[model samples]
Target: MLAKANRITSADDYRVIVRRGAKVAGAHTVSYLRSRESGTDARFGFIVSKKVGTAVRRNLVRRRLKAVCHEALGDGVCDVDVVVRALPSASAADWNEIRAEVLNALERRRARASIDAASQKGE
Candidate 1:
C-alpha cells in the first residue's frame, strides 16, 4: 500500500482527477489518474465499496487491486496519483486474471496518452 501523501484524499481531488485525468478501465477495475507535480513519483489509492460484498470480500478486492497497482506502476510511471475502483466481480477474481487486466489497462492508457500528446503538439 502507498503512503498517505501518495493517496488521493479529498473529494475535490478525486473530482479534479476524474475531470482532467487519463483513465483506463479493466474487466474488474478502473484506474483514474492525474500526473503529479514532480513527474518522478507515483501515488495510489484503492476503493472497494460495500456494494462489492462483505468486509472480507471488500478487503480481498482492495488487496488484489493494491498488488496489481504496485506491480503495474512500479518505478515505470512517475509523478502521478492513481485511484483504482473495484467492481463486484473483482471480489472473487483470481490474482493473475486481475493482474493481466490491470497491466493491459495501464499499457493502453499510456499509449493513448502518448498519442494524444503527440497530436496536440502537431507532431
Candidate 2:
C-alpha cells in the first residue's frame, strides 16, 4: 500500500506532471516522472481507464501498479512525482510483468533525466 503522503491526490498535479514530466513508455504502461525539490517521498498517481477493461479488471491493474510502486519505493525515486498510465495490455499482465514494466520505466526515465542534466552541464 502507498502512503497518503506518497500519493498524488490532486487533478491539477496529475495534469501538470503528465504534461510536463519526462515520459517512459513500456508495453504495459507509460510512466511520467517530474522532479521536485521538497522531500524524500515520491508521489504517485495511476490512470487505469476503460480501455484496459471493466471496473474489476481496471481495479486489478491499478492495484498491481500500486503494488509495484510500493515495492520499488526507494531513494532513487525521491523528489519526484510519477503518474503511471496503464495500457490496454496491462489487464492481462501478471504482477511480475507489471512490476518489471513499471520499475524499468522508472529506471529509464531517471537515467534519461540524469543524461540530460549531464549534457547540459557539459555545454
Backbone Cα, N, C clashes tallied per candidate: 1, 0
C-alpha TM-score for every candidate: 0.80, 0.88
Model 1 bad stretches (over 4 Å): 120-123
lDDT of each: 0.76, 0.88
Residue lDDT tens for model 1, 1-123: 755655667887777777787778877887787776665667677778888899989988888877777776564865667777788888878899888877776677677768978999995
lDDT score of residue 18 within candidate 2: 96
TM-score of model 1 vs. true structure: 0.80
Taking the tens digit of each residue's C-alpha lDDT, what string does model 2 give over 11-112? 999999999998888889999989888567888999998999999999999889888888778544777899999999999988888898888887886787
Best by lDDT: 2
RMSD of 2: 1.9
Q: What is the lDDT of residue 78 in candidate 1?
A: 59
Q: CA shift at 86, candidate 2, in angstroms?
A: 0.5
